[model samples]
Target: MKTFARLVDDSANFSSDITYKKGGSILSMIETVLGKSVFQSALQSYIRTYQFSNADHEMLFEKFTEAAAGTVKDWCERPMNVTRFLDPWFLQQASALKK
Candidate 1:
């Protein structure tokens, strides 16, 4: 799988397969990991905080981590904040799946 960041460099990578299919899968994983309540709250907070402003991944991650309240580490089964947990998914060109 290509990284989300990589898709921006080439318009060719912009397709329903990547943007919708894979993106939906990734979102599902994140929601599952963060739990519905925390995930929804984080998204709500992010939108509310940046509705009329610019927001980057780091900003969104900060909201997620803040809403997680340290439970991200437990949910991820490792010691990591939302940024660390999501970096590979967004920044690296590989499957973020871990067994």
Candidate 2:
């Protein structure tokens, strides 16, 4: 989120950020980042440098909303509203396993 905010800091495009990836294989993807802990620590340092300003989740969310709406519909996809967990994003193909 910090990197994203910095990338668009020049523009008031935070309101339109509609990206919210699901929990499908995100855990696996996160595991691929070997030095994630180190990266997170560095990020925390940056956060601390600005925490005194009271800029936090709520403020970030507000900016994100502005960015998303400013961009075209294809810029990013919105989160899905589901009545059940039967969606494929949570499912894996059994045939993909060699066992």
Candidate 3:
């Protein structure tokens, strides 16, 4: 899929497809890039900080990037923004996962 629906209409019927699976794959990529412990900590921090508060995608991007920078090993350093890093996998077709 070129893009995913952020919110599905309640009146619309749900379809099971690879696009639905993509979200989990993206999280898996994050866990692979950052260690599982680091990813978990970051996810928890995001939830705790934004609980009962409306949080946008930028907030999530910032939290994950901050956590990765602090925890990821020196060799895996990334110079790009976390949102940019993730956008390709999210916006492009499913083939991106092969990388």
Per-prediction CA RMSD (Å): 9.0, 21.0, 9.3
Error of 3 at 79 (Å): 5.6
Query: Clashing residue pairs, candidate 3?
Result: none
Local lDDT at 30 for model 1: 77
TM-score, one value per model: 0.71, 0.24, 0.66
Residue 31 of model 2 has an lDDT of: 24
lDDT score, candidate 1, position 53: 98
* Candidate closest to the true structure, highest lDDT: 1
Candidates 2 and 3 compared by lDDT, better number: 3
Candidates ranked by TM-score: 1, 3, 2
Positional deviation of residue 3's Cα in model 3 after best superposition, in angstroms: 35
Model 3 weakest 10-residue run by lDDT:
71-80
Cα RMSD for candidate 2?
A: 21.0
| TM accuracy, model 1 | 0.71
CA lDDT, every prediction? Answer: 0.79, 0.35, 0.73
Clashes of each: 0, 16, 0
Error of 2 at 37 (Å): 2.2
Off by over 4 Å in 3: 1-15, 73-80, 93-99
Ranking by lDDT: 1, 3, 2
Q: Candidate 2's residue-wise lDDT over 1-99, tens digit each? A: 355534445354434332123332432332232135533443455466566776653343233333333231321344312211122333342212223
